[model samples]
Target: MTVCEMCGKETEVFSAIIEGSELTVCAACGRFGKMLRKPVMRVVKKQAVEKAPGPVETVVTGFASLIRSAREKAGLTQKDFAMSLNEKESIVQKLENGAFVPPISLAKKLEKLLKIKLVEFEQEDEVSNEKRGSGPLTIGDILNVKK
Candidate 1:
C-alpha cells in the first residue's frame, strides 16, 4: 500500500497534479487535484511499517553562554551586535541571559555572525506499535467489525 503525500495516510493512492505539483494522494485529497491515474486496490497486509521520523534541528544547550562569549570575543557590544542583526538590543540581551530561546532563523543568523555552533540535528528513534498493539478501536472500526 502507498502513503498519501498530502494527508500521510496509508492507502491506495493515485498520481495527481495539485497546484502545479505532481503528487500521489488518496481519494479525498485527490479531489483538490487533477488525477493522472485511477487508484488501484491491492491486497491488504496484516502489518504496515511506518517511515522513520526525520531529523529535527534544535538549539544546543548552553547557548546563552556561547553567544555571550562569542560576541565579547568579537569586540562588539550588545547594542552593536543587535544593530548588525537589525534586531533590538533587548532581544540580544534576553538571548545572552538565557531568558529567551532563539528560533531556527535567529539561531542561524547568530551562528553565521558569531561563527559558533548553535543548532544540532537530532534523530528521533522509531516507535514500534506492535508491542503495544493498537489502542481501543474507533467507532468506525467497531461498526465495521464482522459478526
Candidate 2:
C-alpha cells in the first residue's frame, strides 16, 4: 500500500488528488486543503489543536542563530541577504535578534535565497527521541503545520 505524503495514511494508488504541481494527497488531506482554501467564516471547528505557550524563546533564538550562521557561511552580510529577499536590512537584523517571526512563505523564500535548510526543531527532536520502530522521517513530517 502506498502512503499519503501529507497525512501518513495508507491508500491505494488511484485514491489521491493532485494538488499543485507536487502533491498527490489522500482524500482527507485533500479535504483539508479545501478547508484551508475556504473563507474563515464558513469553517467549523478544526481538528488541529493549538499548543499552549508558543515556541520557546530559546527556540526563536536558535532559529535566529541558524539564519545568521547560514548567511555568514554563504559569505553574505545581513544587508545583502535582506536585499536578496527583497526585505529591509532592519527586518533582517530584527529576525537575527529574535524580535520577529517570519511567515512560512517568507521562510521558504529565505531558504531558497540563502540555500539553507531551516527545519522545525521539535520535529527533529521527536525523530531523534524515538528509540525504535520509528520509520524514516520525511521532510513533510518536519514541516507539518502543527497548530
Candidate 3:
C-alpha cells in the first residue's frame, strides 16, 4: 500500500504536484498539493523525444541574503519593507532568515521592489531537488493544496 508523501500516513494515494514535484500521497496529505487531471499520452517518433524536456527553472539561491542586502541597501527596516509589500514584519524576518520558501506572488513583489531576479530559466542545465527538511505547518500551507 502507498503512503502519504507529506505525512507518512497509509491510505489511498492520488498523484499530485506539490511544490514542483509529482507525488502519490494520501487524500489528507494530498491536500498540500494540486490534484492533476490525467494527461493523454500519444506515441511519437524518436525525433520528438529529444525535444520533450523543456527549459529548467531555477530559483535564485541565497534568497535570504539577497532580501536582507537589498532591504538594508534601500535603508528599509523589516517592518517598513513588510508594510510596503502588505506582509507582516515577522514574515519578512522569517524570509530573511531562510525559514521557508517565499510564495511566487511575494517573490514577484520582492523582484520589483528589490530589483533582483528571483527566478531564472536555464535552457541546458538540469537540476533535481529532493524534499527539504520537515518544517512546521500552517493553515494557509494546507489550504493551498487543491482539495
Candidate 4:
C-alpha cells in the first residue's frame, strides 16, 4: 500500500497520464487518464573507458527564407512539401516562417529534399571579421602588448 497522489489516501497506486501529466494514482483517480502498463526495468554493464566529446556543429541563419525559396523553386506548395517530407503541414509552415528550427534529423531530410545547405561546421582556428578590421595592426597588436 502507498499514498494516493490526488486524494492522499493510503492505498495501492498505478501510473496514469492525466491532463498531459504522468502520476501515480489510485484506481478511482485513474479514471482521469488512460491506465498505463507498469514499466520493465533491466540492468546493463558499462564500458571501462569513456570517449571525449566531439566538436559542435551549428545551423546556418536565413534558413527560413532559404526553405521558402527552395520550395517555391521546386514548384511545390506547403502541403505538397509536407507530404514529400512526411511531416505535418504546420511544421513546414513554422519552418518556413522562422518560428522554429527543425532538429538535426529533420534538417537532414530538408537538405536531401531541397538540396540546400542548412548546417555548417564551426572552426575554432578561424579568424573573425572583427579581428581583420581592427584598425591596421602593428607588431605590438599582434604580440598583445600595451601601446
Tell me, by lDDT, which candidate is best: 1
Give the root-mean-square deviation of each candidate in angstroms: 13.6, 17.9, 18.4, 14.0
* Better-scoring candidate (TM-score), 1 or 4: 1
Q: Could you give candidate 3's per-residue lDDT for residues 1-147 as a string of tens digits?
A: 557678899766778899999987777766788987433335787764444456765667788999999999999999889999999999999999999779777888899999988877767532222232355544544342435
Off by over 4 Å in 1: 1-52, 137-147
User: TM-scores of the models, in the given order?
Assistant: 0.56, 0.40, 0.46, 0.50
The models' CA-based lDDT, in order, is 0.89, 0.64, 0.77, 0.82
The C-alpha local distance difference test score for the whole of candidate 3 amounts to 0.77
Q: By TM-score, how accurate is candidate 3?
A: 0.46
Q: Where in model 4 is the C-alpha error above 4 Å?
A: 1-53, 123-147
> After superposition, which runs of candidate 2 have C-alpha atoms over 4 Å from their true positions?
1-61, 119-147
Model 1 residue pairs with clashes: none
In model 2, what is the error at residue 112, expressed in angstroms? 1.1
Question: Which should have the higher TM-score, number 2 or number 3?
Answer: 3
Q: In terms of TM-score, which candidate is strongest?
A: 1
Tens digit of lDDT per residue, candidate 2, span 1-147?
Answer: 556678788763223334543454566776644322321223477698745534422223366888888889999998888888899999899888878877766777777876766544342234333443467756755563647
